[model samples]
Target: MATTLAEFEAKVLLDQTLSTNHKSIIIPIELQEKEDSLPTNRFNKLFKLLIIYCLVLLVYPVYLGYAIYWHNINSINISWCEGLGFLLVVSTLVYTCLCYSFVLSPLVDHISFDIRFPGSMEKVIQSNEVRCAVSSIIILGCIIFLIIDTQDDRYRLVSAGGILLIILFGFAFSANRKKIVWRHVIWGIFLQIIFGILIMRWDSGRDFINCIGSKVDTFLGFTDSGSSFVFGYLVDQKPFLPTKLENGSLAKLVAEEINNSTAVKNIVVFKALSTVYFFSFLTSMLNYWGILQWFVQKIGWLLQTTIGTTACESLSASANIFLGQATTPFIIKPYLGQLTLSEIHAVMTGGFATIAGTVLAAYISLGVSSAHLLSASMMSAPAALAFAKLFYPEKETSRTKSDKISIKPPSEVNVLDAATQGASSAGLLVVNITAIVIAFIAFMSFINSLFEFFGDQVGIHNLTFDSILGKLFIPLSLSMGVEWNDCEKIAKLIGVKVVLNEFIAYRELGLLIQNEELSPRSAVIATYALCGFANPASIGIQLATLNSLAPQRQADFARVVFRAFISGNAACFLTACIAGTLYNEFTYVQL
Candidate 1:
C-alpha cells in the first residue's frame, strides 16, 4: 500500500495525465486522512453570515414602514413580501453553498471504496436517479401549474403520474442528509435579509442596480433595433406566411380590415411601412451577418462592469467553440469551472429562462407585440433566479472566490475573420432554428394524428395531446388567476412551449388573442411563461457546453443538467406566476 501510494503521488506530481478517471494520480490525499486534510475557513463562513444578517436587518424594516405609512396595501406590499422570499432564496443559497463546501465535500474526500458500501455520502447525492427524481418534482410542479391553470386535460393523467413518480423517487432515494447543517439554513435566511436590507437602505445602490439594468436593456434594445426593424418589415411585406395562418375567421378579419383601409393609395405611407420591412430585412440580414455577435459582446462587457458580470454575461470568458453551446456562456467563461454550483446553476438557469440572441428575431417576427418583448425580457431575468434555486439547492462542494464576471472577446486576425465567424455562427443558427421548427412541427403533427384517430373512435372531438396537457395544467393556471374555463387553453399554450418551442407557443398566443380565447391578464401571463427556452433540448445543450469547458468535471456537469433543466423551466413559470398573480391583483384593485 505504501509503494502504491508513493507511485500514485509521483505520477500526479509528474502531471503525465489529466483525465478525471485517473483520480488516483490527480488526488494526492490518502483515503483515510482526506477529510482531515481538507481546507476549512470558519471566518469566511462567519463573515458571510454576518453580511447576510446585517443586510436583512437593514431592509425589512423599511418595507414594513412603507406598508404602514401607505395604510392601504398594494403591490409594494406584495413586493416587500416577494422581496422577503427573494431573501429567503438567497439565504438558502448561501447556506447550501457553505454546507456543501464545508460539510458534504469533506465527507466525499474521506470516503473510500475499500469499505463494503464503497461510496461517500456525496456519491449518494450525485446519483443520476436521485437528480432525476428531484428534477421530476420541479418539472411536475411546472406541469401541474400548467395543467391546472391552462385549462387542458389531455396530459392530466401523464402529468399526475409524473408527480407521483417524483414523490416516490424522492422518498426512495433522498439526497445525503448528512451534508445539511441547521446553522447554514438559518445563516442563509439571515444573509438574504441582510442583502435585502442593503438593497432597501441604500436607495442609491438599489437605484444604481436598477439603473444599470435599465441602461443595459436600453442598449440591447438599441443594438437589436436593426433586427426589430427587419422583423417588422417582414410582417408588412409578407403579411402572412403561405403555409401558416390558413384562410379562416382570423384571415377574413385581416382581409376585411385591409380592404377597408384607405392607406393603400398613399404611396408615402405605403413606402414608410415598406421601409420598416426593408430595415427588418436588413437587421435580419445583419443578425445573420454577425453584427449582433460583435455588439452583444461589446455591450455585454459594459453591463458586466456595472452589474457584476457573472450576474449576467461576463466579458472575461473564452469565445472559442463559438458554434456550439460553448459560445453561449463564453461571455462568462472566466467564472466557469471555478464557480460554486449555485453560481453555475445561476448561469445555466439564466440561459434556460431566457432565449438566445439567435432567436430574438424569430420571436419578434412571430408577432409578439413590441411592448411585450421588452416586458418578457425584463421578466425573464429575475425569473431565472427563482426557479434555479428551487430545483437545485447548491451543494457544499460548489464555491467560488469572488463575484467577478468574465468573457472572451472574439479572436480574429482581421475584420473579415470576425465577419466570417459571425456569418458562420448565424448560418448555423438559422439552420438550427429551421430544422427545429420542421422537426417539432412534424412531431406534433404526428402526435395529433394518432390522438385524433383514437379520439374520433371514442367520440371525443378535442382529444389532442394538447388538450390533455391543457387539462392537467388548468388548475395551476387558475392558481395564477387565469379563469377556470380559459385555463386549459393557456395550459395547451404552455404545453406547446415545453414540448416544442416558445416561438410556436407565442404564435399560438397571437391567434388566441385574435380569437378572444384569452383575457388581457391571461395574455400577459402567457407572454411571460413563453419568454424562455427552458425546454428539454436546453438540458442537452447545457450539459454538452459545461462538459466541454471543464472536461475534468464532465460527470458532475452531466449529473446536474437534469436539475438545471427543471430549475430553468420552473424559474420561467414562477416568473409568469408572479407576473400573473400580481397583474391580476392590481387590475382587480383598480376595478
Candidate 2:
C-alpha cells in the first residue's frame, strides 16, 4: 500500500493525465464515435447545393406573401415605404429567431433539449406512470370544478392548482434546493395574490388603477402632437386600405378615410412604436432631475422589507419600473461586485420580469387595458424577487445585504441633453424591436409551412406552429382559469408571446379583441400573463448587460441565467393565476 501510494503521488506529480490522489484519472471520458473527414467529391458538393436550394426555395416565397400581407407587393405600384418595411421586417425576424434559438435560449453553453437519468430509473415505469396519473388527476380536478363549483370557488381552485404546479417546477429546477427559504417563497406568492385581489376584484382598487392608466394613456397620447407635427396626417391617422383591395390589380389604393364614420385605427405599426422616443425622452429628464431616483429608493425599500432580498437586488428590481434593464444596474452599480449568485440571479430576473417605463406606451398602444398593464408590472416587481430567490436560494451570505443604495442621477449636462440622450437611446430600441418582429414572423412562416405540410399528410388542417404550441399551452391556459373552448386561442397568444416577444403578442391580442374572439375573462387573464419581457432573446440581453457590469462573474452568470429566464416567465404566470382567481366576470376591463 505504501509503494502504491508513492507510485500514485509520483504519477500525479509528474504526469498531467493522472488524478492528484490516484495513479490513473478516475473520471471517464464520455464515449462518442469519431467522425470521418468530409468528402470533397462532386456528389457531396451537389448534395450541399441541393439543400441550400431547397431551403431558399421553401422559405423565399413566404416572403412575397408576407409583403402582400403588409400591402407592399400591391396590385398596382408597390409603396416604397411599405416595401422597405417588408424587407426590414423579414430580415429582422430571421436574425432574432436565429440569435435566440441558437445562442440565447440554451440552458447550457451548447444549445440542447436534453436531460439525464439513470439506466435503472428508465426501467421504473411505476414512478413515471405515477407522476402522469397525478398530473392528469389535477387537471381533471380543475375540469370537474368548472362544472359544479361556484364561479368564485372554481376559479380560485384552478388558480391554486396553477400556482402549485409552478412552485413544483421551481423546486425541480432549484439550484440549492435544500437551502430554499419557504418564508421568502410564500411571501412572494401571497403578495402576488394580494396585488391580484386589489387590481382585479376590489372596485375602488380597479378604479384607482384605471385612473392612473387613464393619466398614462393621456400622457402617451401627447406623442401624437409631435408625431403629427413631424410625420403629418400619415402618423396622425390609420390607413384605410381594405383587405380585399390587394386581390385586384384594378383596385385603386388610396390613403384616405373610407367614410365619414369609419373605424380605421393605428394600422401603421411604426405609429405605435413612435411612442418609445417620447417616453424615453420623458424618463431621461425625470432621471436627470432625480425624480426617478426618489421613486426607486422608496419602491426598493418596500420590496426589501417585504421580500427580504439584499439591498442591491431590491433596488435593482424596483428601479426596473422606471428604468431600462441596463440602466437599472447603475442604480446599484457600486455593489454589483459584491452580489452572490442568488442575488445576481435576482437582479437579472427582475429585469426580465418587468418592462421599462420607456416601452409602456408602446405596449399600451396595442389596445391592452392600461390599468391591467400597470398592475401587472407593479405586482411583478416583488414577485420577481420572490421567484428569483426561490429558484436560486441564498446559500452564501450576500455581501450587500446590509448595504443601502440609491438610484444615481444620469451624467448629462442639462434637461435637453438628457432628453436628447433618452430619445436617441430609444432609436436603438426601436430598431431592435423592428428586427425582432421581422425575424420571428419569417421564421414562424417557415415553421408553419413545415407543420401545415405534415399536418396535411396526416389529414389534419390548421396545424400551424402557433396552433401546435397552443395545444402545448392548453394545460397552462386551463390553469390560468380560461374557459375550455377559449383555452386554445389564449394559449396560442401565450405561445406567440413566449416564442417571439410580448409586443407581437399584445398586437395579436388587440386583433382578437377587435374580432370579439376572446371573452372578457380570458382577455384579462391573457393581459396579466403577457405582461413581462421574459423571452429567449431577453436571456442574451440580460447576460450582455450584467456581464459588462460584472465581468468577473460571467461564468457564474452563464450557469444560472437560463434559470432566471424561466423564473421570469413563471412569475408572470403566477400573476395571471392570481388575476384569474379574483377576476370579476360581471365587471368589464376598459380595453
Candidate 3:
C-alpha cells in the first residue's frame, strides 16, 4: 500500500505538475486493497523528460571541458588535464545535484508546504545526507590521489580532506529525511551550468566591459562627490568636490611616478593622494553612522546606479555586503523586509564571497595585483548570487517594487552632524581593521612558531604552515590546475586568505610577485584562490551584523551563517579554479 502511494506520488509530480509558475499541485498517496489504473503514456512522457534533462546536464560538462581545454591548448600537452577538467566540471554538477537533493528541496518543501519534520530520519534527509555521502566519496578519491602523488607534497589533499570532514559531519546530521527530492537536484545543477557559462564569457570583451565600467564609474560620481566632500572638509578644511582620476596616458605616467618614487622624492603628490584616500575612507564609514543613516540613504540613492550597473552585469548579492555587511544591503533597505529567501541568500553569499570598495584600496596596498582585484570583484558578484541561491533556496515572499528606492537628504540639521558621523565611523573602521589584522597576525605567527619548533626538532627542516597546508590541500589545489610543485605555496596562500582576509593574502602574493617567488602561472592561480572573504572571522562578523538587525533570529542566523560561510568559500575557490583552468593559455602574457 505504501509502495503504491509512493508510486502515485511520483507519478503526480512527474506527470502534470513541476513547473515553477503553477506549483499548486500536490501528489497524495493512499493505501487501497485493490490495484489501481496506471497511466502508461504519462509514465513514458515523464521518462523522456527525465532523459532529456539528464542529457542536457551531460552536454554542459562536455562543453565546459572543451572550453577549458581549448582555452589552455598552448600551455598543457597532456590530455589528462582535459579529462580531469571534464571530471571536475561533472563533479560540480554532481555536487549541485546533491546540494539540491538534500538541501534546497527540503527548504522549498518547508517554505511552500509549511511542512517541518521533527524526527531524525526526515531531518537527516532534509539536511543533506546524499550531498554529504557524495562529498565524502569525492574526498576519499582525492585522498587516494594524494597518496599516489608521492612526487608532490600532500597539502591540497589534506585541505580537501578537512573540507570533506565538515561535509561528512553535515551528512551525519542529515540522513534519510522525507524532504529529499531528486528532481530539484537536477534543476540546481542546470542552473549552475548556465551561470558557469555566463561567467566564463563575462570578460571576453574587455572593451565593452570597460566602457560599461566607465559609465558606472561616472554614475558613481554622485556618491563619490558626497564622500569627497566629507574627506575634503576634514583634510583641506573646506567643502570639497570629488574628481575623477583618469588612467589615461598622462595619468599612467603619474601613477608610474607614484609607484616608483622614493618616499622623500615625491612627498607632495603622495600626501595629496594619501589625504584623498583617508577622506574616501571617512565618507564610506559615515554612510553607516547613526545620525548619518540619512546620508547613507541618500548615497544609496546615488548608489542605485552602481547597483543597476552590477545587476546589469549579473553581479551577486555579496556585492551588497562587500564594504560593510550590514550597510550595503540597507542601500536597498526598502526591499530588505520583503526580500525572498533566494534574494537574501544572494545578499549574504555575496557579502561572504567579496570585499567592499573602501577596503579594495587597502588590498591593492597589501600586494594584490590590480588585475587580480578587478577580476575578483567582477567574477565574485555573479558567482555569489548563483551559489547563495542554491545553498539556501528561497521561500515565497513579496518582491520589492522596481525603482522603489530614492535618495534623500540626511536628517541632521547641520554640517557638524555629518562631520562627527564621518569621523566616528572612520575611527571605528580604523580600530576594527587594526585590531583584526594585529590579532590575526599574532595568532598566525604563534601557530607558525609552534610548527617551526616541532619541525626542527623532528628533522623535518622545511615544515611550515604552508608546507603542511600544501601537503594537505595540494590535491584540491592541483585539481584546480595549480602546478604540483607550487601547491604548497598556494596552499599557504589559501590558508592566509581563510585565516586573515584576501587583503593580507594578496599582499603576500604581491611580495611573492616582487620577489619573483612565483611563475606567472602559479601567481594567476593564487590570485583566483585568495579573492574572497571565507575565513572564520568573517563568520563572526556576519553573524554579529545579522544579529543586530534581527536580534530574535540571532540563533538561527548563527547556525545558518556558518553553512553560508562554507558555501561562500567553496564558490570563490571553485570560481578561481575555473578561471585559472580556462585562462591557462594566456599566462605567457606578462601580468
Quote each prediction's TM-score.
Answer: 0.50, 0.70, 0.51
- Candidate with maximal lDDT: 2
Show where candidate 3 strays beyond 4 Å. Answer: 1-204, 207-322, 332-346, 395-424, 456-459, 584-591
Candidate 2 versus truth, CA RMSD in Å, comes to 24.6
**Which RMSD does model 1 reach against the true structure?**
19.9
After the best TM-score superposition of candidate 1, give how far the Cα of residue 291 lies from its true spot, in angstroms. Answer: 13
- Clashing pairs for predicted structure model 2, backbone only: 89-438, 92-439, 93-438, 93-439, 93-440, 94-439
Output the lDDT of residue 524, model 3: 71
Tens-digit lDDT string for candidate 2 (174-193): 88899987656766666676
Q: Any runs in candidate 2 off by more than 4 Å, and if so which?
A: 1-153, 238-269, 402-404, 587-591
lDDT tens digits, residue span 1-591, model 3: 999999999988876655632454322222121123256666889999898778756776676668667768857543322445445644776667657756897888777546777697676775667656754665465446446642344433433343344333323433232332322223222332333334333454433334333433333334335543555433233321222345556766665554444222222112222323454445544543432344333333332333221221122243343444645654554444455444555566667776665555555544555445555665655455545544554454435543554434456555566556655665566556667777887887888888988999988885667567657766656666676677778887887777666656776787888898887667776776677777777777777776666566555565567667766676676556545533423323332
Better of 1 and 3 by lDDT: 3
Error of 1 at 230 (Å): 12
For 371-428, candidate 1 gives per-residue lDDT tens digits of: 4444455445544443344344446554333344333444666555555565555555
lDDT of 2: 0.77
User: Least accurate stretch of 10 residues (summed lDDT) in model 3?
Assistant: 263-272
Q: Which lDDT values do the candidates have, in the order given?
A: 0.53, 0.77, 0.54
Residue 298, candidate 2: how far off, in angstroms?
0.8
